[model samples]
Target chain A: MIGEARIVKLDNLTLLVIMVGTILAMSIFLPERFLTVTNFQSMSSQFPEYGLFAMAIMLTMITGGIDLSVVSVANLSGVAGALVLASHVKAQAMGISPGTIIFLAILAALVVSLICGWFNGLLITAVGVPAIIATLGTNGLFMGIAIILTEGHGIRGFPEEFLFIGSGTILGIPMPLIIFIGVALLVSLMLKKSAQGFKMYMLGSSPLVTRFSGISNNRVIVKTYLMSGLLAGIAAIIIISRVNSMRPGYGYAYLLLAVLLAILGGTNPEGGRGGVLGLCMAIVILQVLQSGLNILSFSPFLKKFIWGLILILFMVVNYYQTNGWPMRNLVRGGVKTGAS
Target chain B: MISKLFQRNETYLFFVIMAFSFFVTVMNPSFLTVENMFDLVKSSSGMAILAIAFFVGLLSRGIDISFPAIAIAGQYIAVNALIAMGVDSLPLAFLISCAVGTAMGATNAFFISSFRMQALIVTLGTSNIFHGALLVFVGTRAINTGKLPHCFKAFGHMNVLTLARPDGTLYGLSVFAVLLLFVIILTWFILNHTLLGKSIYAVGGNYESAKRAGFNIKRTLFFVYGYIGFLSGIMGVMHLSLIRYSNPNYIVDTELLRVIAAVVIGGARITGGSGTLTGTLLGVIMMVILEKNLVLIGLSSYWHQFFIGLVIVLGVSITYYQSKRQNRRNLLFTD
Candidate 1:
């Protein structure tokens, strides 16, 4: 039992070490302003958007699937909310009360997000399309709809009350950061203690086995994608609130970054393993690197290159650790058929 | 006999293309004109090259989403080199661009086959790297037609065959259209007649069995991805010539999706080992017709994406149903 516990925590320990190492390295090489309170506040505020996206991706990846449509769904959800607010603003200018409009806008965003998620679920489950392909199709579909709705422009002029959820601070902590923490805590609880999480892991490990156990894998897949969609919805709310605007192409760059964060956080791409803590640590490490790079005045293009390199490096490391070294065989040109 | 003919996915695709064309011609009589046909084929040539690349990769149970990025990088490098060197030789520029593309493809093949990583994710990471490199090294400036040699611009608009229309507009076969034909024929020959092509099919069909049968999996994978890169390089040059400009910020994101959708709609399985050049050609034509007609029929260009998405889902569903029926027949036979 003790050995098993240690094994379970191995990834967590590695992540913690990486996080601390990144912070120490950043502090040493960067200027003194890197560790300032204002810098920390800004970093915290920015990291949550990426963190939420990573969490959204992690939930689906744990089930041996992927969702390429999360960013599109988020953009669409935000677009829906923005439209609602825009119309409300127009009505308020004409002397209509805007009190309930904000709440209604939030509700509309969540509903649209859920519908988009359900569409993904339906495609994967009922239509029998592969998850990646299904989500790829929906990514285009959602983005196209968003473009048509916004007429290829951004919607802005959100009320202050709506913006407060994204930028407002409570007890010296940013609201977005708090929301990210709350979602992470809730997801950790679900994965560790919930029966549904058990089913999800089993499904990922072996779908046939899970099906034989009579657990309705289809239902679980739908629910998993739904949860991913819901997280994207919440992230959209924060993003729109913070930016004070929404566009059809917002958060386009975040898609790959979120995937990198999840995989770097020790979430296995092949599934049946991962945790929210590792994800949080990975997000923090990336945020620190990003912040440090900014302070050093590195080009944004270089940042993308670094992120790509890091993703590939971590994948290579993970492969070596999990499957043992295959370098010799690779050089010898020998076929190891069952290695994978 | 009818059932056997209908059983082939290509048959359905061909009919769909025909039906769609007929519908569009009815909606807008000018859609069926020879001038529009030439324009359609010219526009689709670049996409056709990429679709063939995607088809070959899918046939081998691998995917290279980085081909578009490779193409963009190739164009950036080639155009920048041409402008800087003041080289007027179009052939030399094309060769340089293809060389760069092949190098990028080789990098993808190295990581994928050596590390045994998932091809999709590996290509995704490499794509980011390539795009970033393009931005950093090439910058975001658009190289204009004025910087290109006069011969290159003439080559872009050169017609192999021309016919005078009643209204005095010349309808002609574009050079890129000819290139696309050659590529299709070459790909077909490689996939059907070559030993490497057979090996690729076997590897994608069953990895362990292929290895047991003495196939060089790494070399095959390298050739597959490298070939895609080579094709992408050619397409990149062609695209630059056609548009008369090269920009790093080109609409590559949508272009990649269109290629994938065309290949998939052509009955290529994402899982690998089954697809044909003929079906892929039909798929490409179908998509081009659909897109062109959407604008002709008074819909906004934005709706084109929405319709393409719908087509992909519908095509995949049809393929799924056919496969399900095939599986049921196999089960009955076994029992």
Candidate 2:
């Protein structure tokens, strides 16, 4: 038990140290911009949107599954919200009140995202496709639907109210940032203290035993997917509101980022082993890294290269620690045996 | 008779491809032209290589979503190397480009084998890192491959042979198309015949069992990732040759979907332990032909991406259902 605790404790604390270091580095490097109230506000605002994506992905990861379609689903919801709002007002038309539209738009997006997630879940659970393939297939399907609806164009001219939800400031605090923090706290509670979260871990860690324990396996899967979809919908609103436009191609970039955030935060791809705190920190670290690179005049391509290199390094390190390095195989009378 | 039916499950994806081809051809009369077919094959070559590469990892019961970016990085680096070295020879340039890709593959393997980290996560990280490194190395602008060497130009533009009708319509085969076919044949041979190749399937089927049977799962993973990197390297070279330029922005959502679809459509089971190079080739062709035909029939290029995704989902669903039923039947028989 002591040995196990050491491993678990190390994994949990690793990201906390990293996040603190990032904050320190940024404050020192770009003192005025990075440490300011305005900067924090701006950073926090963007966090909720990306955080929502991270949450959705986290839900799937906890279920021993993944959803590549989150980005596509978010894109669809963003476009749908924009289109519905735009078509009504005719001049970047928005006939609905700002608050009402925000609620309705999010609801609509969540419903669509849920349906898409359900489709993916059905394929994985019922048709028995692997999570990667099922999600990959639906990723294409959702994005394709977005393309048909938007015809490669964008939906713009949203009502001022929607923008406020994304951009509005309350007593020098960004609304999006507030929303993001609120959601994060809520999710952390659910994961850390809730009965369902424990059950989720049991299912993820040992589905066979858990099923024998009488957990509704299928319902749990569907429920996780539903939550993932809802989170995706929330991300859709924040993203479109931030950008002030909705393109069919939106959220394409977020797919990889969301996965990175989840894993970088210390959520295991093998499932039943991870934390939301680590993921949130990972997101902040990634965003800071991107911001730093941007400030340094690095080209976008260079940014991708940096991201990839770090990813590879971290993975290699993770692999070594988990499975012991320099893996050796046996030889049977001059014939080489395999490495485990 | 029942045994024969289960054996045919592997080949069912081909029927789907043929049906799609027929449907597209019916929608547009000119869809079956030799030139169009050649172009389709050429367009798919880069992604086809990736699909084959991906098949390696899948057979090992692991997945790498980062191959596309790796391919892009390899393409960027190789092209940059060529410009720096001032190489005018296509074959040598291709060789050097593949070497770079192989290095990337080795790096991926090192992490997976040495670190015990998840492939999905490692690849995801590297995808960003590789892309970022490429940008820093090459700067923001794309390297135009056509301006560099005459032989390199031929790689994208030159046709291997031509077929012409009395009516004077020029329809010919491309060297790139031939190259794609050769690669496919080579992959099928390796995957089917080689001891190392058979090990991949064995490991993916059941890693614990394979280990007990004296297989090196680590070495298998290393080789699988290395092979994928090699494919990506070849693709990087091929993609730069075809497009005549390397653009970082080109690594977008559409690219990931298309490449993955090609692999999944080729009848490669997502769960691993089962896949074929032939199936991947067909999947690549099906995707390319469908996209081309859709555009030819007046569907927007934007819509093509969306529709292709739908087709992949539908195709996979059908395949998954069929396999499930077959599995159930086998269970029943055993019982």
Candidate 3:
């Protein structure tokens, strides 16, 4: 039993080692510039948008549900922010302060994101639609709304101050990276220490048992998705700022990547297991691989293929770890073994 | 009579489709014409075929979101192979596509059956890999099939029956639409008549009980996923034939949602073990009609997505409520 526990504990550590190994391998094979500060800065800046979305997905996955509409929500929120900024910039020509406009735009984006999250919660809990189905529907709905609002064109030309939130550095660190760190810290604290977090894990492990224990599973689920929505909102701000544009189709590819990251981070798809630290390591590894691929001039599609391969490989590893090697039983003619 | 009809899931969908069609026709009488009606069916044939794949996967308690990717990949392979060989045989192209699709499906089945992973995640990973491979191996250029033999082009546009419009354009029943009907009948027969079909339901209904009953659960899952892939390949070929071109990026994103929505709306329970081909057929028609008429009703193509999403949630909600009520009734009776 102790040996099994030790092996289980080493899973995340093994993942970290694999991540570091990949980075080291990339550094050796690639040019000297690969390890330079500028490359690290660019990689760090590029990863936070995806990293933030992964964290959002991780929060919901912890509760045994998924938020498939994270990208759509982010797009919707970002579009809302962009519209606000675009209109406000026009007002700026009439002497309105850019600072206040930027603040208001940010607030608008976050608020829209919260509402979208709340709506997802209502669909799952109140309407009794399964999380995956509900979010799949809402994903379309949100993206459609964004398209209708923007008429299929990207909204661009944001104020310099707003762009700084995405592109500017503080203490030689990219702003988006700093924001990701702060969000990661807060999420980790919530998952590790909060009563709600405990309840989420329990609910994920056994919904019926949690309900019988007098915990309102509905409320927890709602709160969990709401947090996911909020994170997507934050991710939207970073993405829009980073690109200096907002469009309905922005970050469409990241939806799959976010799910991939969360799963690679060792979060159980069925829920009730995983942590922020594991997720952070997973994000860094993927970001490094992505940056490495970029430096090596690999096709973007190859990167997607690698992420997909990793997702399947990790799921297989996780299954074996949790279920205790199905092949052992297969070899033994389906007889139960004490070790299994 | 109404209550009895309502008790049957397909009937409710049929009425909904009828009501929706009536509303659309009322808004724009042009939509009521025979040509327009046939055109709608013709265009929807591809989606209906894809939905059939979705229906099969859902029935066996596994959801395959990779069908669209598989379809595009298979089509690309078939088209490129035909182009390289300088052949214009539609049947040969279809055969090649199905073969490629079977391989892709078998890959999904291998991992899913061997590992017992969640079908959703497995398919998601495979989808990315398939699309990525398509981009890397085949390249993203849209290949025009204009150089194909005249017979092949003629077959693609072949109409069984024709109706001449007042404006001198002719519209008629397409070969693809006929193919869809044949597929629907074949799938219905498989689901309702065959022993393998029975095994599929049994496995989905209760995995442990099915195992005890001597059913090979892994084999059933493998066969179901493979069958869906096979159908997806056919759909892919049909899609290429209809469009007269092949593009790697075609049918990437929103197509998956549409297929899922159609299956769910057709009264298939997401939890698995219960669904019917007839119900699925009605569901596909309803979705296709709504999509086609949305533009006629002055809504842009964008709103079509919003409505599809709305219908899926509403459809699932109704199913959830109905099932809950049934469970309550059963519990009360047992008590």
TM-score of chain B of 2: 0.88
Q: Model 3 compared with the native: what TM-score?
A: 0.94
If both were scored by TM-score, which would come out higher, candidate 2 or candidate 3?
3
- Using DockQ as the measure, which candidate wins? 3
Model 3 pairs whose backbones collide: none
Instruction: Give candidate 1 regions above 4 Å deviation.
Output: A1-8, A90-99, A326-340, B167-169, B325-335
Runs off by more than 4 Å, candidate 3: A1-8, A93-96, A325-340, B149-151, B162-171, B328-335
lDDT computed for candidate 1: 0.84
Residues A234-335 of candidate 3: C-alpha lDDT, one tens digit per residue = 999998888988878888889889998898888887878778988988998888888888887898888878878888998898888877777876867545
Summarize candidate 1's per-residue lDDT along B1-335 as a digit string, tens digits.
Answer: 99998878899889988888888889888888888888888888999999999888888888788998999888888878877787777887789889999999999999888888777788888888988878887787887777766656887889999999889977798988789989988998989999999998988888889989999999999999999999999999899888888878784578988988788889887654887788888889888887777777688977866777777777777765566557667863110
Q: Give TM-scores for every candidate, taking all chains together and pairing residue i with residue i.
A: 0.94, 0.89, 0.94
Task: Supply the global lDDT for candidate 3.
Answer: 0.85
> How much is the TM-score of the A chain of model 3?
0.93
Interface RMSD of each: 3.6, 3.8, 3.5
